[model samples]
Target: MANAERRYSKDHEWVRVEGNEAYIGITEFAQDQLGDIVYVELPEVSSSVEKDEVVCAVESVKTAADIISPVSGTVIAINEELADQPEMINEDPYSAWIMQIELSDPTELGELMNAAEYATYCENEE
Candidate 1:
């Protein structure tokens, strides 16, 4: 499960909102499933993305996966540190956010699932 305050997407991304900007990353469960992360292809800073769109890509020992945006927004920042230490996400997915977005429609956050709800949803998916 993700941190209680973070919202989750069906695609396994997590969104931690702060004012109009939100940090986005794959959930711990997703990282665990991915095994060791090797590289990440982050969206260009200032790139506009729509909710549910593929905003980034993560490569792991097991497979490569697309990281979908949970909210429509412009990418304002990306974690450059991940380029040197992609495995950081495997160690701490929540703290190792991939990008920060300036929301185009903050109301899209309401469409996300809370921790408990996501946990249940994940369980049912398996």
Candidate 2:
């Protein structure tokens, strides 16, 4: 429950801002939907991106999905560990982050929902 109180996007992406950077990862629901993760394509460090833009890509047993950015910014870090064991996403989606960005819009977080709200939203989604 690392982000049990963190904000989430409608796309099932989660955002947890710590300082000027925001950690990005797919939700458990999204992970479950994708099945076992087999590959991850990440953005290069120092690359720029916009909100709702594809920052990375991930492929699973069932499908592949673009890792859309919740906020516009420059990528500062990516988890290279996933290259060897992408299945870590299935093991712990929250911890298996795809990337981190120095945000362009801090207000974007204000527009997202906290974990409790996201959980309720996810419930209604089904």
Candidate 3:
């Protein structure tokens, strides 16, 4: 089940807003499809990103995928722990967020899908 508090993208990324910042990561469905995660290439802190832009890369045993940013923002922080424990994403995609961004346009969040909608979207994709 997708977390109710977060919004999801058709590209399979999830974003949870807290104050003015949004934490981003791949959805659980995405990780399951990707197989075992082997490495994660995160964006540098303070980098600016536009909505739908490729913000990072996730490499799994099966294949590699680009993680798209769901909203425009300036990257405030990245999960440095992922550098040593990439598998943590497979362990828990929701808790193992890849990056945090200070939202440049909070209204952009309105375009994202809610948990239930995302669940339906994933069902259709499968």
Candidate 4:
């Protein structure tokens, strides 16, 4: 299930917005599907990215995957912890946000799915 307060992308990334910044991470479903995470490559702070761009990459024992940005923005911060403890995402994907983005246009969030919609989308994907 997706968190009620967060928005979701079709690719299974989640975004939790706070003011002008939005925290990005893979959903629980993503981590589960990827198996045990071994590494996470995140964009540097101050790097600009567009909506749906590949801003990060996560690798697991099963496979590696790209994390698409849900909105256009400049990266404000990244979870440096993931460099050493990528498994933290498997334990708690929502809480272990990979990056923080300063949204170029906050309205981009309106295009994302809500919790209920995302849940249904996941169901359909399965």
Task: Write down the TM-score of every candidate.
Answer: 0.97, 0.93, 0.98, 0.97
- Compared to the true structure, candidate 1 yields what TM-score? 0.97
The list of candidate 4 runs beyond 4 A from truth reads none
State, as a TM-score between 0 and 1, how close model 3 is to the true structure.
0.98
Residue 105 C-alpha lDDT in model 1: 100
Residue 88 shift from truth in candidate 1, angstroms: 0.3
lDDT of the structure predicted as candidate 1: 0.92
Error of 1 at 25 (Å): 0.4
| Maximum-lDDT candidate | 3
Q: In model 3, where do residues sit more than 4 Å from their true spots? A: none
Worst 10 residues of 3 by lDDT: 1-10
RMSD to native for every prediction?
0.9, 1.3, 0.7, 0.8
Count clashing pairs, candidate 4: 0
Model 1 / residue 32 / CA error / Å: 0.9
On TM-score, the stronger of 2 and 3 is: 3
Better model by TM-score, 1 or 2? 1
Off by over 4 Å in 2: 2-5
Residues 15-77, model 3: lDDT tens digits: 999999999999999999998999999999999999989988999987889998999989999
For residues 1-126, what per-residue lDDT tens digits would candidate 2 score against the true structure? Answer: 536556788888888789989988898998888898999988899999998887788999778998888889999999999999999989999888888999988988888888888888888988
Which residue pairs clash within candidate 3?
none
In order, what lDDT does every prediction score?
0.92, 0.87, 0.95, 0.92
